[model samples]
Target: MKIGIIGGGSIGLLFSCYLSENHQVTLYCRTINQVNMINQCGITLQKKDSSILSNIHAKLSTERVADELVLVTVKQYHLPELLPILDKIPQHIPLLFLQNGMGHLDYLQKMKHDNILLGVVEHGALKISLSTVKHTGFGTTRVAAYKGDMQKLMAIKNTLQMSNFPFEIEANYNEMLIRKLVVNAAINPLTALLRIKNGDLLSNNYYFELLKEVFQEIIQVLCLQELEDTYFASIVSICQSTSNNYSSMLKDILEHRQTEIEGIVGVLRNKAEIQKQSVPFLQFLYTSIKGMEYKRWDE
Candidate 1:
C-alpha cells in the first residue's frame, strides 16, 4: 500500500515512520528544508527505551498527491491554506483527516472527494526536530467514514492496522469526532492556560473542578448529558495515562507557535451561538488562549 501523509508535524512524522515499516510512505512537508533533511537523514521515531530510523520519501506539499491513500494530519488552522492543493487530488484517492476538532467537518463537506475518513488520534507525539518525533504515549486510532463507501474504507482500515498502531473503524463519524472535541475542549485550553501538564488537571483539586465545569457547559451546549459519564471517564483516563506529557497546544505556546484554539474551543462557541446559550467558562478559556497567542505574536 502506498500512503501519502500530509503535514510534517509530530502526528504526520509518527504515522510516516510506522506506516513505512509495512508500506510505501511519502511524507509531505511544508518547506524544502524539511524535505531535504528527511531525505538525507531519514526520520527518527524515538521511544522511551530505543529509537528506530525509517527511510521514507519526502516531498514538498506543493507537489502532486498521487498515492492510493492520504492522511491529512495538519493542524485545523492550516486547512484553509491546503484547499488548493487538495482540490488537485483525484477524487478516487481516499483522504483520511486526523485533526483535533470537529470544525473540519464543515470544510470537508464542501470538498469534491467521495472517500473521506475522519480519525481520532489518541496517541501523544512530540516533534523533536525537523526529522525526528518522540512517541510520548501509545494509543489506538479510531476512524469513521465521513463521505465514502464503508466497504472500501474498511479495506483501507484493515491494511493500515498494526499491533503497535491499532486502527479501529467507528460506527458514527459525528459521535466519534464530538467525543474527541469535548475532550480536547476541556483539556487543551486549560492546560495551555495554566502552563501545566495533563496530569495537573487531575492532581490539582481546583483544576479538576474547573474541568468538570467546562465539561458541563460543553455537554449542555451539545446536549450530551446522556454520555457525560462516558466522556468524563475518557478525559480522566487520558490525563492519568498521559500525565507527564504536555499537550500539543501547550507545546505550541511554549514554542511561540500558533495554537489550535479556534478548532477546539471556537467550534463550541459557534454551536453555543446557534443554540442561543452562553458558555461563560468556555468563552473565558477561548479568550484566554487567544490572548496568549496575541502575546506570542507581540513578543
Candidate 2:
C-alpha cells in the first residue's frame, strides 16, 4: 500500500512515520523547506524515552499525489486551500480526512471523491521541528466510512494499523465525529482561554464545574439523549488520560495562529439557533476565541 499524507504538522509526521513502516508513504508539506528536510534526513519521531528515524518520500503539496490512500491531516481552516488540489486527484482514490471539527463535513460532501473516510485521531502529537514530531500520548484512531465501501475501508485500516498504533472501524460517521466534537467542545476552548494543561481542568473544582456545564450545553444543543452519561464520562476520561498535553487549540492561541472554533463551537451555535435554543456558554466561548484571534490580528 502507498500512503500519501497531506500535512506537515504533527499528525501528518506521526502518520507518515508509522505508516512508512509497513507501506510506502509520501508526506506532502506546504513548504519546500520541510520537504527538503524530510527527504534529506527522514522523519524523527519521539515518544517518552525513545526516538526512531524513518526514511520516507516527501514532496510539496503543489506536486501531484499518486498514492493508493491519501490522508488529509490538515486543519479545518486549511481545507479551502486544499480543496482545489484534492479536486485534481482521481475520484476513485480513497481520501481520509482527519479534521477536528464538524464544519468540514458539508464541504467534504461536495467533493468529487466517491470513497471518503472520516477519522478521529485520539493520539497527542507535537511537532518539534520541520521533520520531527513528539508523540506525547497514545490512543486509538476510530474511522468511519462516509462514502466508501466497507471492504475498501477494512483493507485501508488493515494496511495502516500496527501493534503500537491501533485502529477501529466505527459504524456511523456522524456519531463518531459528534462524540469527538463533544469532547472538543467541553475541553479545548476552556484550556485555550485559561492557558492551562488538560489536567488543570480536572485538578481545579471550579474549572471542572465549568467543563460539566459546557458539556451539558453541547448535549442540549445536539439533543444527544440516553448517551449523555456515557459522553460525559468520556470527556472526563480524556482529560485525565491526556493530562499533561496542551490541546491543539491552546497551541494555536499560544502561537498566534487561527483555530477551528467555527468548526467546533460555531457548528453547535448554528444548530442551536436553528432549533431556537439558547446556549449562552457556547456563545461565550465562541466569542472569546474569536476575540483572541482578532486581537492577534490587530497586533
Candidate 3:
C-alpha cells in the first residue's frame, strides 16, 4: 500500500520507519530542514535497545498525492490548515486521525471528510533530532471506522497487524475515542504543569489528587458522550501503562513549544459548556495551562 503521513513529528516518522519496509511511505513535512534531511539520509528509528533502522522517504509538501491510506497526525490546531492540503489527495482513500484528544472527529465532520477513521494508539515515540526518533514504549492501538465502513476498517486493521504492529479494532468508535480522551485528559496536563514524566505523577501524592480531580471532570464531560463507564480505574490503567514515558504535553513545554492544551483540556471545557454541564476542574485546568503556554513566550 502507498501510505502518506501528514505530520513529520515522532509519531509520523516512527510509523514510516517500520511500515516503509513493505510499503511505499511518503511523509509530508512543513520545514525545509526536515525535508532536506529525509531527502538526503531518510529517517532513523532508534529502538529501546539502541538498535537503529534508517532510510525512509519524506516529502516537503504534497506533490503527486496518490496514496491508498493517509495518517493525519498533525496537532489539533493544525487541523484547519491540514484539511485543505488534503483536498488534493483522493477522496476515497482512507484517512486515520492519530491525535490526542476529543473533537477531532467533529472538525472533520464539518469539513465533510467522511472517509475518516479514528484510532487511539498507546505506542510512544520521541524525536530526539530532526530526523531521528526513539521508540519508547510499545502499546496496542484500537481503531474503528466512524462512517459505517466496516470492510475498509477491517482491511486497515489486517494490514496493521500483519505489519507486526500491536493494534485492535474497537467495535464502537465513539466509546473508544471518549475513553482515550479521558485518559489523556487525566494525565497529560498535570505532567505538563509539574514538569514531570508520566511515572513521576505516581511519586507525588498531591499530583495524584490533582489527577483525580481532572479525571472526575473528564468523566463528567464524557457522560455527555454516553461514556459513563469510563471511570477512574480506566484512567489509572493508562497511567500505569505509560508510566515511564514523558507525556507529549511535557515534551512540548520542555522544548518551549506550544502544547495541545486545547485538544486535551479545552475540548473538555467546550463539551461541558455545550452540554450545560458544570466542570469546574476542567475549566481551571484549561485556564492554568493556557497561561503557562503564554508565559513561556515571555521566558
**After best superposition, candidate 1 residue 208: deviation in angstroms?**
1.4
TM-score of each: 0.98, 0.98, 0.92
lDDT of 3 by residue, 8-70 (tens): 888887888877877888888889889889889878888866756667777766555567998
Please list all clashing residue pairs in model 2, or write none if there are none: none
Model 3 residue 78 lDDT score:
80
Q: How many residue pairs clash in each candidate?
A: 0, 0, 0
lDDT digits (tens) for residues 5-34 of candidate 1: 999999999999999989999999999999
lDDT score for candidate 2 against the true structure:
0.93
Q: List the residue pairs that clash in candidate 3.
A: none
Residue lDDT tens for model 2, 64-168: 999888999999989999998999889899999999989999888789888999999988899999999999888889999999799999988888889899999
Error of 3 at 74 (Å): 1.2
Q: lDDT of candidate 3?
A: 0.78
Ten residues in a row with the worst lDDT in model 2?
106-115
Q: Over 4 Å off in model 1, which ranges?
A: none
